[model samples]
Target: MISNSDISKVIAGVKGQINEQDTSLIVAHLPLLEERLQYLAKSFPSETLHAIAIKTNPHPQMLKHLVGLGYGLEAASIEEVNMAMAAGCAPSKIVFDSPVKTRSEIDCVSGLTDMLVNVNSIGELNRFPSEATCTIGIRVNPQVHTGAPEMFDVSRNESKFGVAISSKQEIINAALAHPVSALHMHSGSQMKDLEVQRGALEALKALADEINATSSGKIHTLDIGGGLPSEPLSDRTRMAEYGAIVHEVFADSQYKLVTEFGQWVHAEAGFALSRIEYVLDESRVFIHLGADFFMRDAYTKARPFALEVWNDTGEFVQGEKSSFDIAGPLCFAGDYLAHGAMLPATTAEGNWLSINGTGANTYALWSRHCSRTVPKCIAFDGVHSSIWSERTTINY
Candidate 1:
C-alpha cells in the first residue's frame, strides 16, 4: 500500500523534475503493481493467463513492466494490441476484444503470431478472414447483472457489449461456423461479490459445454472477462478467495482460464497529485485536474479515491481537518471530484492535494473537453523514480 510518506518520498526526489506549468502529477508505485501481480499469480491456476487490461491505465512503461513480469495484455482495440506489442508482449500473449472491430482491424492482427480475438457478436465474427492465423472466440453476455454501477455493467440485457446468453444457440453456432476456440464473459466492473463472478463463469462454462458437445468445434479456453472488485493494496486476501472460487468451480474442467482485470491490478498502486489553485470560503477548493483526468469520479461519485494534503515544502499536512468540496478546472455544472471531502483545515492555494486509488481509470479516460494538457506520470520503485510520461500539450 502506498502511504502518504511513500508519495512524499517520491515528491521530494522528483520535485525538481516536475514542470511549473504542469498542474497535476500521476504517481505509479511499481512495488504495489508487483504486489497485485504476485497476488494474482499465487491465487489463480498455473495455466491462467492474467491479461492485464490496457484500457485502465495505458502507461507505456507500466505496460512494459507488466509484460516483463510474465502477464499478458488484454486490448479493447487494435491500437491497444499494437501497444501491447510495442511494450514487448508477444502476439500470442495478447487478446484483442473490440466489440466493433472493423475489417481493416481484423485484417491487421490476423497475421500476428498466435493472437487471440474474442468477437463480440455473430456479425463481427463474420468479419474475420477465413484463413487468418489468429484464434477466434465469441464474447457471451451472461445477462446476469451483478448490480455493479449501471454505467459499468456490460452484461445488461440491452447492453451493446457481447452476444447475450439468450442467444446461446447463435453463439454456439457462431463458434461452430468460425474457427472459435474460446468463450469470453465480462459482466461489469467494480463488482464486489465473487459469487456474481462465479455465476457468470458458470454460465460461460455451460455455454462452452454445449459448444464442445458438438463434433465440429471445441471451447478450449474460457476468457472470464475481468470485473473483479479491487481491494485496498493492504488487503491481499481477495485474490486467494477469488482463486478458490474459480478452482472449486472448474477443478475438473480442462478449459484454460484467461482473466482481464484492470482496476484490480492497478487501482491502489497509483496516486494523483493536483495543485490547489484556489481555496474559496475555506469550504470549497479548486484543483488543476478536473473531469479531464477523472471522468468517472467527476461523472459518478462511485470511485473510492482517498484524499490527502501536502504543503509546498513536500511535507504531509496532518492537522485538524475540515470538509470541503473539491472542484476541477473544467467548465461544467457537475465537475466536482468530491463533495465534502475532508482535508487539512489549512489546505490553501499552492498546497498539493493527493488522490489515492487513481492508478487505474483516471488518466486513461482523460477527456479533451477542456483541452487541458496531459499531465506527467512518474513511476517510483521505492529506490528511484523515473518519468513514465512527460506533461505535454493536448494535440488536437
Candidate 2:
C-alpha cells in the first residue's frame, strides 16, 4: 500500500523527459490484489455468496485471477460473458445480468449453463428460452436510494434498472407461470448503507417465500446483486459487517446467497500514472496524462462536490495545496479528473504522478473521441513484473 507521502517523494525525483505522446506508465501490485480478493473471499466464504461484477476492470488476466480465487463472474452482456469464459471461468460460475437482452445474446448463452439471469421486466421473463435450464433472478427496486446524488438519482422511480417492489408480485406471478428458477434484487450501484442492503434482502426473501409457497419450482438461489461501495478515501461498509448482514438476512432460508461486486474487488489494486504537463496557474496546476474519459478512473466522476486542479509535478506546491485542478489532455473541458483539491507545493513540470489506488484497466470506459490511443497496462506480482497490455495506437 503506497502512502500519499511515498507518492510525494516519487514526484520529487522525476528526471525523465515527459512528453504528451509518451505513455503514462502504471504498476499493479498483483500480490496486494490477490491478498485483497482472498481477504474478501475468506471474510464472506461460501456462507455469504460473493461474485465479481465484470464491468469494472475486465482485463482477461485480472478476471482469470479472480475466477481462480473462487469468485464468480457477473456479466452484463454477451461480450462480457465471453470475456469471463475466455478467462477460464465456467458458465456455471457466471451470472448473465442485464435489464435488456437481445435475442441473439440470449440464444447464444441459453444452453451454455445454469447461469443466473437478473430479469427486470415481465417481457424479459417471457422472452427467456424455455429449453434453457436457468436459475432466474429478478432485480427488485428497493426504492431506498443511497450514495452520491449521481448514483442516487438513477435509482429513482423513473430509473430503468429494476422492477418496483410493489410490482414484484406481478414479476413473481410471471416467473411462477414461466420457467423461473431463482430470486434476485439490486438496490443501486455504490451503495454504502447496511439498511439499504437489508431492505433489498427483505424484499428478495419475501419474493423467495412467495415463490416457495405458490410454485412447484424451488427457489434455491438468492442473488443479492453487488452495489458495494468502494470509496478509496473512507470505509463505507466493512467485509465483516457485510458478512454479518448476509448471515442475519438468510439465517432461516435454505437458498444459496450470492453477491456480485465490481469496484470493491479491484479499486485499490492498481494506480493510474501520469505526468504534470503544465501549471495552469499558481493555485491551479494541470497534470496531463493519458486516460479514457471515464469517471471511475477520475475522482471527478464520483464526487462532484470536490474540486479538481492540475499540477505539473505530482507533488503539491507549498501554500497552493487547497486550490488546484487536475485535467486530462483531451480537448473537451469536461476531461478533468479532480478540481479544487490540495496538492504538494513541490510539484513541477515533467514529473510523473499516479491516479493512486485505481485499477490497471481503468481505460475500459474511455471513448476515442479525440483519437487518442489507449494507455498501457502493467502487472506486478511482487517479485516478477510484466506488461499486461500494450499501448493502444490505433485510431478508429
Candidate 3:
C-alpha cells in the first residue's frame, strides 16, 4: 500500500506542475501494484494463471505495464480483449469471461489459439464455433451466497451471471455436449469470509469431479473467480490463509488453476486527488470530483473511501477534527462522497484531499452525466512521479 507520506512527497514535488485549471489528479504507485503481484505469487501456485481483470483500471499504460510484468489479463468484453491483445498479452494468456458475448464477438475470440473462453450460460455455449481452437468452459454460479454486497454478488439462484449449480444435470449435460475443459465460479467481490469462499470452491470441485466421472473429456482447469477481500496492507496473512485454503482444496487435484482478481490487485495501489472548491457552512464541503469519477462511492453506501487533507502549501493537515459532509460538484443531491466525514476543521477551499483506496473500480467507471474531464494520472515509484496518462475529455 502507498503511504500518505509517500503521496504527500509526490504531491509536494509536482505541486508546481498542477495548474489553476486542474481540479483533480489520480496517483498510481507502481511499487504498490508490484506488491500486489508479489502477494499473488506467494499465495497461488507457480503455474496458476493470475488473470488481472482489465475493468479495474483500463488505462492503456496500466494494461501494458501488467502485461510486461508477465501477468494475464481477464477481459469482460470484446473491446477489453482487443485492448489486452494490443497491450501485447499473449493469446493464451487472455481469458474471455464476458456474460453477453455476441456471435460476432464469439467468432472473433474463438479463432485465437489457446484462449480460454468461459461461457456464462448454457444457451451461450451453443454460440461458439464447433471446431474452434480456443478452449471452452461454463461458468457455474455455485449458488453459495457469501453475504457479499448485493450489487456485487452474482451467485444467487436467479442471478444472470452464470449457470446455477442447482441445474446440475443441465450443467453436466452442457459440459458433456461441448468441448469443455474447465469450470468457473465467482461468488462476488468484497467478500471477506474465507469459509464462504471455501464453500464455493468445494461446490465447484464437487461439480468438476462429477463431470469428470460422467464425461469422456476431463475437466483440466478450475477458474475460481477472485472475490477474496483484499488484505490489510500491514501484512499478507489473509492472502496466505486463503492460499492455505486453496492448497487444502486443490492441492492434490490435476486441474489447472486460474484467478481473475480486479479489486484485489489494484484497490490499494491508487488514490485520487481533488481540490476542495467550497466549504459550505463548515459542514458541506464540495470537491471538484463527485459522481463522475466516484460512481460507486457517491451512489452506493458500500463503497466507502478514506480522505486525507493537505493545506494549500501541500503540507499534511493534522489537528482537531470535525464532521463534514464531503460532496462532489454534481447536479444531483445524492452526489456525496461521504456523509459525516471526519476531517480537520481547518480544511478549506484551497486544501487538496486525497481519496484513498480508489485504485480499483473508481475511474474506470467514470460517468458522463456531468461532462467532467477525466483526471490525469501520474505513476509514482517512491522516488519520482511520471505522467501515466493525460486527462481525458468526453467531447471527442
Candidate 4:
C-alpha cells in the first residue's frame, strides 16, 4: 500500500501547490508501477510475456511506459487494441482476450505476429477466418471455484465466461477445428491462495494436454489469465508462492507461458484525493462524488483505502479520533465511502482526504450517471505532476 504519508509527500511535491478545495484527482506514481513490473519479472520465467491488462487502467502514457519496460498489452476490446498500437506495442505482443467479440472485431485482427486471441466460446471461433494469422485459443472455464465475490468468480458452474469444459467432446472438437495454438483459462478472481490457483491451473493444463494431444503439438502457449488481487491488500508472498505453483504445474509441458496481470501491477501505484464538501454531523462527513472516480470502492462499499485527512491549508490533521462516515457526493442513499470509518476528531469541511491503494479498477470503472466527468489524473515521476489527459476539459 502506498501509505498516506507517501501520498501526502507526493502531493506536497507537486510543482505547484494543490488546492485542497479542488483536490479530486488521481496521482499515478510511475516509479511504483516500474517497481511492480520489476517484481513480476522476477516471479515469472524469463521467456514469459507479462501482458498488462489495458482495461484496468488504460492511460496512454502508462501503456507506452509498459511497452518500454518490455511488457505486452492484454486488450479486451478493439479500442484497447488501438491504444496498444499507438503506444508502439508490437501486434505480436498484444493478446486479444475479449469474451464478447463482434464479427467485425474478429475479422480486423486477421494477421499479427505472435499475438494470441482467446475467444470466449466455441461459437466465437466462427467469426475468425480459417487462415487467420495470429495464435488463437479458447477460454476454458476450469470450473474451479475461487470463493470470490460472485461477480468476480468466472469458474462457477453457471459462469458465462468461457466454453464450458463440461462438454468435453466439444472442447476437443473446437481445438481440432480452429486455428488455435494455445489454451487459455481465466478463473477471473484475484485469488492469491497458491493451492487454489494451482488447482485451477491443473484443471486447465489437463484440458490443454487433451487439446494438444489431439492437435499434434498445436497448443504451445498457456495463457493463465490474470486477476491477481489488488496491491497493498494483496499478499506479495502469496503471489510468489502462486508463481511457484504455476512452474510446478507445467514442469514437464513444453509450452510458452503468457500472463495478463492487472490489479497487482497497477493498484499500489494509484490513488484518488477528494475535497471535503460538507460535514453532516459529528461523525458523518461528505466529500466530492466518488462513484464517478472510484467505483470499485463504491461498488463493494469497502474501505480499501487508508484514509488521511489534510486541511485546506495543507496541514495534516491529527488528533483524537472518532467514527467518521465519509459519504459521497452522489444522489443515491448508499454513496458512503466509509460507513463508520475512524478519522481525526478535527475532520470536517475544508479538509480533504487522500484515498490510497486505488491504482486499478478505479477510474477505469467510473460511472457518469450523475453527468460527472472523471477527474484528471496527475502522473508523478516522483517529483513533479502533469496532466495525463490530452486536454483540460472533463469530457466524461
Candidate 5:
C-alpha cells in the first residue's frame, strides 16, 4: 500500500539542483523505512524479534533509526556487531550469525549475557569451551533447496552455512553435543516459495523434538533467517496474505520466534542516482564508474536496479524509446547497467538516471573494482533531507 510519490518528488527536486556538489547519490526514504517496519510489526507477533539483518543495508544512520524504532539487530560480522552496539543495540537484542567466526571474534562476544550466537560449523563448536557464557545456538541446514542461486542458497546439501541435516539424527546430535538451546535455519534469500520456508521449519521441528526427547532441555528459540522479498511497490494485499500464511504455519510452534529480514524491510525504501556521462550510440550509454556503483548488478546480473530517466533539468524524459546498453565508467567491457534497456532516445550527458529498488543490496554488496568513491548516502524526511554518511571511501 506504499507509494513512491514522496520519493519521486524528492528526486524531482534534486534534479532542479543538479548543479549541487553531490548530485549523483542515493536516498533512503525514512518514512518508507518506518512504514515497512510498522507493516511488518503489525503482521508478526509482537513478541517476535524482528531482527534487521545488518548486511542488507548497513548504512549507520539506518541502524540508528532502527534502534530508535525498537527493532532488534541480526549481525553477521564483528564490524556489524560493533555497528549495532554503536547504534545503541542492547546485547540481548543482537543475534550473531556469521558463517566464519574467528577465535578472537568468538572470544569477544562469549560473555554477552543474552546475545544469541548461532554457531556456524561443528568444527567451530569444538573450539568453543564449555565455559563460554553466551547463549549457544546451532545453525541447521534443512537440506530443503528453494531453487535460489547457488551462491545465495544456504540450505543446499553442500552449503558452507551450517550443519547440514541430511538426517534427523545428524542435526539432533549436533545440537545436543554443542550445548545449543536455539536452532537457526536460513533456507535462502528472496525465496520463491514460502512453503519451502515452512518445510525447512518443519524439518527443524522434527530435529527439535528429537533433541527434547534425548536431551534434558527443550529448544528455546527459532531463528528463521532472511529471504523474504522487500519490494516497496509490491502488491500489499498479497504480501499481507503471505504474512498471514507464515503466521498460520507457525501458530502452534512452542519456541520463541525470531525473523531476520534485511531486504524485505529496506529494499524499496532506497534509490540510486547516476549522472549520464554520454551515450555511445543507440546500443551503448556510459555512466560514471559503471561497475563501481552497482558491482553485483553490472557483473552477475543478480539484482539489476530498475531505472527511470530524467533530464538534467529534473524533468522526466518520455519519447520514442530505444534499447540502450547502460555501461558503467569502468575499463571492463561488461560494466553495463542493463544489456538491453528500452530508454528514451533523447538521453544525453548530465541527464540523471534514477535507479529504483536500490534500498537493499545495491550498495551493501558493492565491490571497489575500479577504485571509485562510494556514493554519498542521503536520507529524506518529507520535503527536507540530509546527508547521513559522507565517510571518505575509495581504493587504490
Candidate 6:
C-alpha cells in the first residue's frame, strides 16, 4: 500500500527535476487514473462499451492508457476524433457526440468508421448523410438541470443541449423513419445527483423500448453522455453506485450500455502546482505563480461548492480565517480565480501551494490573455515522472 509519505516523496522528486520558473505545472497521477478506470471496468464488466470523454484533459498518455484498457473514445469535435485516431483508437471505438454539428464537421465525420452520431435537433437529423452507415443517437434533454447554474444552466428553456423529453417521441420517430440505430441522453454537465442521472437512464430506456417497438432494426446502443461529477463533489455517489444504476436501468435490454465519463476518470489524477511569488501585506497574500487558464476551473462557480486550498509547506500561522481572494498573473479584473476564499492565518509568499483537483494539461485551456505564456505539464506514474509538455515563453 502506498502511504502519504510515499506519494509526497514522489511529488518532491518530480518537482526537483522541473524548472522553477515554470509557474503553472500540472502533474498527472497515472496510477490513480488507471486504477479508477479499472474499477469502473470491473463494476460494469457486462457492459460492451465504455467510452472516455475527450474534453477533460486529453493528455495523450491518459488516452493511451484508456485505449490499452480496452476503452473507446467519446469525442465531441473533429480535433478530438483525430486525436483518438492518432492515439491508435480505431473509428469503431469512437462515438462522435457533438449534438450541434456544423455541415462541414458533419461532412468531415461522415464515412469515418462506425462512428455514432448524436443528433440534438430534427434539422440535424435531416442533414445526416444518407450514404453513411453510422449508428445514429438522439440526445434527449431531461429538462432537469443538475450542475452549477453558472456553468451548465440546463433547467432553463434557454439552454441548448439536447432535444427535450417532451420531444423524444418525435426524435425517435424521425430516427426510425430515417432508419437510424441508437438512443442517447445527457442531463447536464457536472452532474452530482444520482437520482437525476438515474431518471435520465429511465427515460432513455423508455425511449429505447419505443424505438425497438417501432423500428424493425434493434436499438443497439444507449449512450449516457459525459457529465459525471468529479473530485471533492462526486463523493455523494460512488462510481460503483453509478454502475449499479446503469445495470438496474438496462437490466434486460440487449442494448450496449455506454457511458462517457471524462472528469471523474481524470480529475483526481491531476494536481496543479503553483508557487508563491511574493506576499503583498499581512492582510493580503500575493503568491502569483501559474494560471488555471479556463474561467470554468473555478469549482465554486462550476460546481456550486468552493474548493479547499492546501498549503504544501505545512505552515499554520494564525491570523483571521476570513475570506481571501486568489488571482492569476493576468491583467484583467476578471483574472481572479478564487475570491472570498479562506486560507491559513500565516500564509506567506514563497510557500508552494498545490491545487489538488486539476490535471496535467489542465492549462491547455489557457488563452494568450495579457499575452501570458501557457504553463507546462508533466506526467507522473506515482514513481516515474517525465516532462510531457514544455512551458511556453513569450515570443514576438
- TM-score against native, each model: 0.95, 0.84, 0.95, 0.92, 0.90, 0.84
Worst 10-residue stretch by lDDT in candidate 3?
A: 228-237
Supply the TM-score for candidate 1.
Answer: 0.95
Q: Report clash pairs, candidate 5.
A: 230-264, 290-328, 290-329
User: What stretches of model 2 exceed 4 Å from their correct place?
Assistant: 4-21, 45-49, 147-154, 231-237, 280-284, 290-323
What's model 6's TM-score?
0.84
lDDT of 6 by residue, 302-370 (tens): 322223333443332345575666666766555555666676655666555555656422554555556
Q: lDDT per residue, candidate 5, 39-97, as tens digits? A: 88777766788889988888888899999999999999999999999999988889999
lDDT of each: 0.86, 0.66, 0.86, 0.79, 0.77, 0.67
In model 6, where do residues sit more than 4 Å from their true spots? Answer: 1-7, 145-150, 153-158, 231-236, 288-294, 297-325, 339-349, 393-396
**Candidate 4 C-alpha error for residue 184, in Å:** 0.8
Clashes of 3: 0
RMSD to true structure for each model, in Å: 1.7, 4.2, 1.7, 2.3, 2.6, 3.9
Cα lDDT tens digits, model 2, 1-396, are 445544443333332432366446554667667766766766553665567888878877778888887778888887898998899887778998876788777777777867887777767776767887656776766666655256434456777877777787687777678777777766666677777667767777888788888875477887877666554322444665776777777777788878787766676776656656676665555654533634444534533322222245544435444456777777767666766656666566765556666662365576666776666666666544466776767665
lDDT of 3 by residue, 29-133 (tens): 898899878888778877889989999889889999999999999999999999999999998889999998999999998889888899998998888888888
Q: List where candidate 4 sits over 4 angstroms from the true fold.
A: 15-21, 233-236, 312-314, 390-396
Q: Please say which candidate is ahead in TM-score: 5 or 6.
A: 5
Q: Model 4 clash pairs?
A: none
Span of 10 residues, lowest total lDDT, candidate 4: 14-23
For 37-155, candidate 1 gives per-residue lDDT tens digits of 98887788889998999999998898999999999999998889989999999988899998878899998988885788998888887777788888788888888877688889888
After TM-score superposition, the amount by which residue 134's alpha carbon in candidate 4 deviates from its true location, in angstroms, is 1.2
